[model samples]
Target chain A: MRPKTLFDKIWETHIVHEEAGKPTLLYIDLHLVHEVTSPQAFEGLREAKRKIRRTDKTFATMDHNVPTIDRNNIKDPISAQQIETLEKNCKEFGIELFDLASPYQGIVHVIGPEQGLTKPGSTIVCGDSHTSTHGAFGALAFGIGTSEVEHVMSTQCLWQNKPKTFEVQVNGKRPKGVTAKDIILSIIGEIGTAGATGYVIEYTGETIRNLSMEQRMTICNMSIEGGARAGMISPDEITLNYLRDKPRIKTLNNLDSLMDDWIKLASDEGALFDETLKLDATKIAPQVSWGTSPGMVTGINNKVPNPKNFEDPVKRKSIEDALAYMGLQADTSIEDIKIDTVFIGSCTNGRIEDLIAASKIIKGNKVSSKVKAIVVPGSQVVKYQAEKLGIDKIFKDAGFEWRESGCSMCLAMNPDKLSPGERAASTSNRNFEGRQGKGGRTHLVSPTMAAAAAINGRFTDVRSFDVDLGEY
Target chain B: MEKFQTVISRPAPLDSSNVDTDQIIPKQFLKRIERTGFGQFLFFDWRFNDDGSINEKFILNEKRFEDSEILLSQENFGCGSSREHAPWALRDYGFKVIISTSFADILFNNCFKNCILPIVITEEKLDYLFKSTLEFEDYQVKVDLENLILSDNKNFTEKLDIDPYRRKCLLEGLDDIALTLIHEDKITLYEKASIE
Candidate 1:
């Protein structure tokens, strides 16, 4: 037998049929849904009079439009109606829903791993670009359009041209205060926004193996930002440790046999990939995005890049436009750029460990008078765990508004948004123009960096801060 | 979905690279359940001012490009979130085809689902098209999907390539779900075998 990559192993196992002159028909093991993207898909099913093929495999949640501040009072009529529509669809189709009243309700991507639905060697699809987040467990997961979502709901299958495999090998130990968010952002900066257009990336090397599952998820969550539909890390003991205590895993039989299978899912030695790129993790610094695109980023101590540094006319134009939208001047120190808001929540960095890291920096300091900072956890489970650890109290004592969870201020579909012309230091994935709000400027940073910025009202380096995030 | 074979119309040139989906259709309009009526809000933030007035500096606001059925952009078009609403907005706004140097992976797949032909061209050819369209207000191009040819009246003709399966579905307006349901037996067998 030929040596096989992890992606090839998973892709080959999921194949149901491969007809000549057509795309392969692959079976999906999980289908995650949310309020914003599933409404139209259910409507498609209703119009066709088709029943959901596998209700047991589907999961639904309310996010994107739910209010993070006032959890019950949904003032926007359109958003309320959208939520009601999802409730109606889930009820009619007999699909499990994590409603607003349920303790499990949260961002679909966050809750999936929390409940152990995302597993090794399984194929996952959601009507969200961030579905790549589940690939952290070594799954072949990717995002889909509503049409494909409906197709999967009807037939439990998808037709796709197999994507080639790419390897991103990161070696060496990262410095203290640099985080998974910084590593992923630096990768995006090195490989522009369109770097891995037609390939699935498998992150490998000593650096990846040394990180926790939460850190691996943070890296996979933003894989879409680098233009890949999916990214994965080979399953190992870290993956097993994260899944052992999950509720779904606790219900399964023959745990040891399942573990053996998962361990075998790693790529074989001497397996070939279509392309390979290497990075030294030790060289990475705490990154901050300064422009509309994720690729327009620089280290914390550096200044905003000059558009003249780029010789391509089109590249220069993009940089100039991004600078104008961000209300920034060329060669200005990143730490000198003032911010009015600080947002520390998203599927990217909204887990309990992320909250703990941020709380460590904000324990004794107050948020700047000029900055309004909020910390919304990723899920109800994460929220409960943080409160149990007294992390929420630390944030509240430091003048931060500790709130509920639901992708708040990330895409700004809900009430938590930056006002027009407001500048925010955010922990979300994308920094595209108007992503936070119309005419709003967003600079993407990690949780610790966001907390430090909230304290100083500017882009401050977490490395220089006088706190120790011991053993995190 | 609509059947598309060929289109002869003016092309609206979005000269920017990495034109993300959030800008194509902002999140504010995504709350609506129905898919139609999105053309009115296409590029809402860029087309309209904060005070609800028209911004004449935007390219789509120009009178000559009012009825464009084709969109021409630089590399990495539709680079952000996987909202199929981006293609719906472009389709609703009378764009049947998009030409670019490259496209984001999810958005590229979503275009085929929405009956839009996404064509990839070389940098040199795209530069020619951008220059010609910017120079002439009434410039038009002919996109023949059946023969995989893109041509203008003057001095440019290039052969394009598309996946045969996607091209066939668009040319015939076939329903993807209905087509896949034909393999129900195989799917069921695979499910049963895996369970055992």
Candidate 2:
């Protein structure tokens, strides 16, 4: 038998049909939907008079436009209407929905993993790009458009070209302050934003194996930022451990047999990859983006890049434009950049471990008067866990607004947004121009980095902060 | 979806790389359920001032590019987010084709589904197109989907590549939903066998 990459094995298994020169019709095991993207998909189904073929496999949630603050009372008529439409559509289509009050309600990416719906070797599709987040569980997950979403809803299949596979191997022990967020941001910086275009990345080597499930999810969530179709870590004992206590896993009748199958989901030894890149994990610092794109990143100790240093005219112009939009000076120290707000949550870094890491820095400390900081947990379950450990109190005591779970200030679809021209140290992925809000400047950072920034009102090295991780 | 055979129209030059989905249609405008109205809100933050007046500094607001039907952008156009609204806005705003050095995977797929021909050209060609479109007033390029060619009618011409299945689907105005319906019986059979 030919040696196969993990992605190749999963891709071959899900294929329903294929011809010599046509895209394969791949079977989807899970279809996750959200309010913003699913409305049009449902409308397409309604227009066609088609029914959801497998409603049991589909899950719906109202996340993007839902208000993180004032959870029960949604004021904006447009947002309210979108949410209402989703609820109504899910009911009509007989698809299960995790509504605002539901315990499972959270960001579509966050809640899918929390409920154990994302499993090893499964194919997951959602309308949102962050659907790649589920690839952490060894699933061949990727984002699809609303039209494709409708196709999956009606046919339970997608016509997809098999993406080439790339391997990102990271070795050596990570430095204490450096995290999964830092590691991914570093990789993106090393390989420009479009480096992994037309490929799915299989993260391997010592560093990936050592990461906890939450940390792995954080890395996989940002794969899109690097232009990969998806990023996955092969399932192992660590993945099984994460799934064991999940609600969906507990209800399974054949857990022992399922575990055995999942353990075999790794790529075969000597499997071929189209391309390979190696990174020394110990060299990664607490990273931060100095420009609008995730690729325009530097370590916390580094200075903003001078566009003049770029040899390519196009690259130089992009850097100049990014600097102008971010209101950053070329060659200035990144630590000197002042921030008015600090956002400490998103699917990228909103899990309970992320909160615990942030709280470790924020405990017994106060946020700078000039900085407005907020902490949003990834899901209701994460929020409950944080609160149980008094992590929420730690943030509240440090003057950070501990809000309900949602994609708050991540893309700023909800009321939680930075005002125009406000500079923020954000833990979310993507620092695209005005992504957080119209004319809002976002500097992407890890949770610990964001916490340190909140305390200092500027980008600060988390390693230098007088905090003990053991206490948390 | 509309059937797309060929288009000959003036091209607008957006000389920026990594023009993400949020920038195409900011998250604020994504609340609308209907796809048709997004044209007005396309590049809302960039097109208009905070006071609701036109920002003439923006290239799309320029007089020469007013009625352009083709968009010539730099690498990685429509990079972030998987919003089909990005294409909806572009199509609504009267762009029949988008030519770029590269496109994010999902955006490239979404463009075909929405009948917007996304042409992946070489960097040299993209640079030539960007330069020509800026230098000449009312510069038009002809994109022939059936022939798989992009020509300026004068000197520059390039052969483009597209998946045969996608090309067939677009020429016939067929979407994935329509294509999938052809094998509804197979899908049903597979689903039933797995369940049992």
Candidate 3:
């Protein structure tokens, strides 16, 4: 047999059918659905008179448009309607739902792996773009649009073109204060957003292997931001340990056999990738995105770049437009850029580990009066765990609003949003114009950096803070 | 989904690269259940001033490009978010053909699901289209889906590269779910063999 990449191994195993001039049909093991993107998909299924092929394989949750402060009283009528529609659709289709009242309810990407529904050597698809988050467990997970969502619901399979493989190797030990978010951000900055447009990236080498599963999820969560189909890390002991006792997998009796099969999902030693890029992890600094796109980022220690430094006319123009939209001037130090809000939550960094890292920087400190800071947990279970550990008190004592989980202020589909012209240092994925709200400016940073910014009311490097930031 | 045929109309050139879906249909407008009526909100932030009035300088606002069915843009046309609302808004806004140097993988796939035909041309060819749209007052291009050719009748002609499966679906206005149901038995067998 030809030495197969990890992606090829999983893809070939899942193939159900193929034709000469058509996309290959691959069976999907999990189909995660959320409110904002699934209503129309359900409507399509109803109109077609199609029953869900496998209700057991499907899971629904309400996250994108739910209010983090008050889940019971949803003031936004449209958001209320969307949530209601999902509840009705899930009931009609016999799909299990982790509704607002359910203890498992959270962002679809966050809850999938946290509950162990996301398994290695399987394929996962979600209507939301952050579905790549589940790839941390070596699953060939990727985001699909709503139409494809309907297809997966009806057939438990999807017609997909084979994606080429790209290996991104980050060797050497990461420096203190640098996180998986920083490493991924630096990689995006180096490779323009479209660098891996048609390929799936495998994050390899020493630095990736050394990170925890939660940290790996943060790295894979933003692969879509870099325009890749999906991003993954091969399974190892850390992966096995994380899934060992998860609620969904604990009931299954054949775990030791599963672990043996999961470990072999890693690519063979001599497997060849279509393309490869290497980054020195030791030299990376904590990163912050200063422009509309995630790729337009810089190290926290650096100043905003001038457009003239870029030779490409289009690149230069984009920088100029980003600076104008962000209400920033070239050559200004990043630490001097003031912020009005600090958002520390999303599928990207809303895990329990992220909150612990942020709280370590926030304990015994006061949030700046000029900034309104909020921390949203990724799942209800995460919120329970954080509160049990008293991490919630650490944040609340620092004047940060500790709220329920559900992508709060990330995309701002709910009432939690930035007013016009208000700037936020966010731990979310994209910094696109109006991603948080209309006329709102966003700067992407890690949770610790966002916590430090909350205390300083400006974009400050985490390493410069006097607090002892623990290991991520 | 609507069938794709030949479209002959003036091209609206949006000379921007990495024009994300958030910019195409901002997040505020995504709550609506039906895919229709998004045309009004297409490029809402860019087409209108903050005070709720139209910005006359935007390309789509120009009288010359009114009712344009072909949209010409630069590299990486739809880059962010897996929202199909981007293509729904574009098709609802009367764009049947979109030509760019490159496009994001997910958006490129979503375009096929809608009636929109996303075409990829060389950078040099795209520059010529952009220049023609900017210089000529009555510039029009005819996109022939059946023949896989694009021409402006005056300047140049170029071939289109599209997947045969995608092209067939667009030309026939076929529903993907109905087509995939043909392999229902194979899907059931695969499910039985796999362990969850």
By lDDT, the best candidate is 1
Misplaced by over 4 Å in model 2 are A470-472
Interface root mean square deviation of every model, in Å? Answer: 0.7, 0.9, 0.8
Q: What would the per-residue lDDT of candidate 2 be over residues B1-196, giving only the tens digit for each residue?
A: 7799699987899989999998899998889887678899888888999999999999999989989889989999999999999999999998989999999999999999889999888899888888898888757899998998889956988887888988888899976777778887777777777665
Candidate 3 docking band? high
Residue pairs whose backbone atoms clash in candidate 3: none
Residues A68-163, candidate 1, lDDT per residue (tens digit)? 888899999999999999999999999999999999888888999999999999999999999999999999999998888999999999998999
Where in model 1 is the C-alpha error above 4 Å?
Answer: none
User: Native contacts retained per candidate?
Assistant: 0.86, 0.80, 0.83
Q: For residues B23-103, write the lDDT of model 1, one tens digit per residue.
A: 999999999898778888889999999899999999999988889998999999999988889998999999999999999
Model 3, which residues run further than 4 Å from truth? A466-468
**What DockQ number belongs to candidate 2?**
0.83
lDDT against the true structure, per candidate, is: 0.92, 0.91, 0.91
Chain B TM-score in each of the candidates: 0.97, 0.96, 0.97
For each candidate in turn, give its C-alpha RMSD to the true structure in angstroms: 0.9, 1.3, 1.1
Model 2 native-contact share = 0.80
